[model samples]
Target chain A: MRPILISCHTRPVIAVKFNKDGDLFFTGSFDGKVSVFWSEPVERLGTFACDGAVKTMTVTEDSKYIVIGTAINGIFIFEVETGTKVKTIEFSSKIHVRDVEFAMGSQQFFMISYESDEKKQSVVYIYDFESVLNREQPSRRDLVRRDRDHYYRGVWGYLNKTIVLGTQNGIIDVVDTKTGELLLSHRAHVNQITSLAFSPDFSMLITASRDCFAKLLDPETLKEIRVFNAQRPLNSAVISPLMLNEGSPKYHCLVAGGQEARDVTTTATDQGGFEITFYNMIFEREIGSVRGHFGPVHSVAVHPRGHMFVTGSEDGTARVHILDQDYFTPAYD
Target chain B: MADADYIEREHIEATADGTYKITTHIKIQNKTVITNPDIERRKTLPKFGDCKNLSKGDIEGSINIEDKEVFLQKSSQVRAEENITKFNLNRAHKEKLDALTRRERAIMSGETEEQKTRRPIVTEREEFSVKVSNLPDNIDQDVLQNLFGTAGRVRKVFIPRGRDDNLPRDFAFVHFDTKAEAEKAIKQFKDYPLGHHILSVEMADRRNQRRNVPMSNRRGRK
Candidate 1:
């Protein structure tokens, strides 16, 4: 499918997400702004400007509040209906939060923060939404500081059951959020892991890294199921949300975005740009490629309906692409 | 006696011409801010008397240089050298010059709020930095620079990265040339919208320093 709608941001779009129903989508830019739009009507609903860069944001499952994490500003909780900020929780002045995710159907959320200390290690902190609404003095419940030896890169909280973190040296740690216990840790890649995503069923995990490869692994055992060498530094990888039925034919596709080979130079005039590559998960081969961004692509999010996906780039804009009709309608022999 | 008198006029004409040349050389030196090679050549001469012993071609050759291409080339060379010399000033000197020029211009033009805002935010390691968070992810360095542009010249915008992610970790360090400008930004940009997100701005704590803290010493809690 072609890009039917194009929206522009004044700065690099860092995060693009579709709401739970796929009816509303929000795009966040480094300029510290968030824009909400109605998906079907393609109309801008409201915009909230933060004090710092809008690094990560999530709408709680109940859709009552939109939680935003700014670069240094702090965590903001806004009422979804009135667009009024309800509460703000700040742990530090200069928090380098990597990711923020709300646990499924829960008020608790988890975030990974990178500290500038000597070892450059990172930690995972969990907070309760009720704390902010309650105007509590201390809202953060658990702070899991990683050891100095391992530097954390990316993080994701799954079903309120586990918080998974990817380290710089390529190890993935699965921890129990409630107990603050590391349930599992395994070396997942040769280099630093940049992003991690799970399939619709949550049975398979996909990881992309600086090592130039994205691998699919079983979430339970963390075993490598398939690997695709992108031959370039990858920033994000996402599995399509089409795999709903367990017995249905596996038509899910993997979408990845990052710098292309020979385009690593940071010069403005350099012929370096990023590409969004799509692959068939079952076949493990690239199916298509889309290129337009003038800089490295940083993040990608698939529409919950699996008909469209969005990608954010260092070039300061996000693009939404619709999947070709043929992919969804599989060819039956 | 007549021959001696003729020689005297020649000497006097040359001396007068030499004096004129010296004045012109000084003027050019001050205007261009370059040390001309011709000035150095004149320095080596024992006296103006030495110039008279030269042949007519020598006399015409030196004077005619003003109309020739060689002088143009020499002036261009001087211009390049002047540029290099100006570029080599120490940081403190450069900053002083910048501040002076800015102040002079501000006085002459009258201070607009925008002009009043332009100051250096990051002067040293931790002095003039403002911590900015909640920035929209789409905003890049240029947008960030423009967002803080009102406060002054942002020395640098440090967007901290995760260990591997290409996008910055959620927050950034905005360094100004001076603490005053940074503090001004904290006041002005509080809850400013950069794009879709409103920014959270504050004077960074001294403990909130640029990268390079020892890993073990990195205190993440509280």
Candidate 2:
């Protein structure tokens, strides 16, 4: 199936996420802009600008506010409807916010930041979402402080009680949000972890890494369930929501990545591995792949309803793909 | 003896041309006719295979007798066998699910046996090597290594030479330890000036050697 290409960003796109209703999706780019697009018709709705390059972003479950983390060591919250800047928190310039995520159905969100100072520490900060928007000084707490491992991405665990963090050294850590306690830690890959995603029901966690493997894990215990192998380093891995449906379940997951951007110029288009690869989640086998991005794909987000998915790439474009009717059929085997 | 008798009256006339004409009148009788009862009865009889009194069993066989005690008993037996197999299959499926870990069961609950048995597709790994062309005749492996060394770790460098001339060729292949390094070299050194000539750098395309062309034949041709 052909994809709807959205080329608005001037630099590499770092993150793409869908709102709770799945009708709209937002893409955050290194160009310091976030674009909102309608998922069905694949039209650009609006754009939000950040002072610094956007590294990661998340929309609230109500789709009312968006939290943007940028390279300038700042987190900005804006009203989704009016595009008004509701709150802005600036940290010391040494720390680069790597990931930001909103807790499901709660006035709480957390961000992971890396400090490139003498200590070389990674920090996970949990903040009260309501305080950030309504109060003059927002209340925040460091869940994991001065950690040695460089965390690349963080995803909220089930019920928003814990947060899962993937690090540059291939370690996965689950930290309790309330008590600031490390719940579980395990070495999950051989190389740096690039992204982490949860299944629609939060029953499984998929982690993609620079080691050319995306793994399925138990969110609570950090146990390995299955592994999907690829030829190139993976930047993002997401499980399709259709697998959780009670009727006509589709056992599929998508992983997108390629040769690093520095290497892309030397490799041919076919050999670059710049495609979103589909894997059978149940069987852990490669089913198919969609190729479009000239550069590596950095992020992918599947619609909540499982009808479509959006991918952001280093090519400075985002693609919205409405899955073919054949993807929903159980005929892969 | 006769129901009605035909009466004829004749009249003769002569014209001036002496031509005579005769006129005659005749009386006819009418009578009612009766049909043969045997022939009518034969016409109303049913044709072949059109009898109303025929039973379904008469046309086919006693296999249509579904309500018989023996037939019912055999069907019940077949159904019981089918139920037993289905029950066994369900039990086997439950056993398989129970054998899986909690996480695996959560991820692979709805997958069938055939789908689980399918293997993953395997892809070939790429080698990191760059081909450098348009080199000076006096260029050696050291100069090439030093030039590409800024990009990444150099694994190996090879320069082919003519057997008779025993001199280095104008082209060389450089292998890097990683794809990133090779890409960096290509980017930094493409069309790089070297000894009055610019070097052309690109990714090495390694095609499979021709199996039909034997090495001995190739050497002979050379």
Model 1 DockQ reads 0.00
Identify the leading candidate in terms of lDDT.
2
- lDDT of model 2 at position A277: 83
List ranges where model 2 is wrong by over 4 Å. B1-222
* lDDT scores of the candidates, listed in order: 0.65, 0.76
The CAPRI class of candidate 1 is: incorrect
Report model 1's TM-score to 2 decimal places.
0.56
The predictions' CA RMSDs to the true structure, in order, are: 41.2, 32.7
DockQ of each: 0.00, 0.01
Model 2, position B104, has a per-residue lDDT of 45
Candidate 2 shows a clash count of 0
**Residue ranges of candidate 1 with Cα displaced over 4 Å:** A5-7, A117-121, A149-158, A245-250, A260-273, A331-333, B1-222
